[model samples]
Target: MVTVSAEESLDHGVPAPMRRGEVFTIHATRDDRSMITHRILPEIAVAQARQLNDAGWQVHISELGGRAFKPSEFYQLLSYKRIG
Candidate 1:
């Protein structure tokens, strides 16, 4: 028979995936500032930027999630920023 403590069991567990709009936990000093990132698609970002620009919102930042993937569906998770 074997027994495991709650702490031991939790230590071996993997963290859940980051949700769409969840703020990340960052290690920083009291005076430091950081961004809470979210995954956004590249094409969508571009289209949205153009739309927002036309509608009167100026975009200033955009970033991608990962590389151009094989399936291509994953490329949708990339992001971009533009100045409108």
Candidate 2:
């Protein structure tokens, strides 16, 4: 019997449908209270991150439950920083 780990299964060729609660989190900070946003779509998260970056805030996008097969763990997907 072959036993596949949860992480391996997730990475398999099979495409998993996006769950309703699946979301991307945008974290932005700039010498102030950090702002966090949860977006269900990647495009929206990227847009928000770009906006934050344009406004001089450092931004990063993370997917919920994307790291170490832990539902509570977040895996960073992209990061943005304003360049002088």
Candidate 3:
């Protein structure tokens, strides 16, 4: 498993410390595409992912420093609003 420093995890767009093995969630968007990835705490991540998925987003659960990770997930959850 890839270990993430406390500074690397985030909550609510704010940088905060995370436990050694703690994971978090990240939402990303580009043009008309969007996905939610998890580096998330299972307690909350799963629920959040399900919620986003229910809203029609592609949700993925991944490790903190695992493959397919985008650095931006550590920053924020992007808007997934659909266009007309």
Candidate 4:
């Protein structure tokens, strides 16, 4: 079995760090335990989103600007309005 690091892995090795909203991609796959592992394909986006928690970024696959992932059944996209 092979493993890859997260999208930001390369950035950490370079002298320059990534901005909070920077995006990158590597490869992603499902492991033998049926757990999905993100390989961080080098062409995808990894932008910061307040919608996310401490990681503060959103990662998803897309083609033609639409979701490439199978629809979620166990989770729903929660929406909230910033009432400030």
Q: What overall lDDT goes with each candidate model?
A: 0.29, 0.50, 0.44, 0.26
TM-score of 4: 0.19
Q: For residues 1-84, write the lDDT of model 4, one tens digit per residue.
A: 333354332323322212222222212333332222233331222221112212422223322223343223102112212111
Candidate 2, 1-84: lDDT as tens digits: 122212211232322223333456677779966887767545566776777778988777665555221212222232232111
lDDT of 2 at 49: 74
Badly placed stretches (over 4 Å) of model 1 are 1-39, 64-84
Candidate 2 TM-score, true structure as reference: 0.53
What would the per-residue lDDT of candidate 1 be over residues 12-82, giving only the tens digit for each residue?
12222122331111111122432222223234434443453455443332222222222223233333232
CA lDDT of 79 in candidate 1?
Answer: 31
Please report how far candidate 2 places residue 7 from its true position, in Å.
23
Please identify which of the two predictions, 1 or 4, would achieve the higher TM-score against the true structure: 1
Question: What's each prediction's TM-score?
Answer: 0.28, 0.53, 0.40, 0.19
lDDT of 3 at 38: 45
Worst 10 residues of 1 by lDDT: 22-31
Query: Candidate 2 or 3, higher lDDT?
Result: 2
Which candidate should be chosen as best, given TM-score against the real structure? 2
Q: For this target, which candidate reaches the highest lDDT against the unseen true structure?
A: 2
Better of 1 and 3 by lDDT: 3
Off by over 4 Å in 4: 1-4, 9-33, 42-66, 70-84
- Candidate 3 ranges with C-alpha deviation above 4 Å: 1-20, 27-40, 65-84
Candidate 2 local lDDT, residue 51 = 79
Clashing pairs in 1: 41-76, 42-78, 61-81, 62-80, 62-81
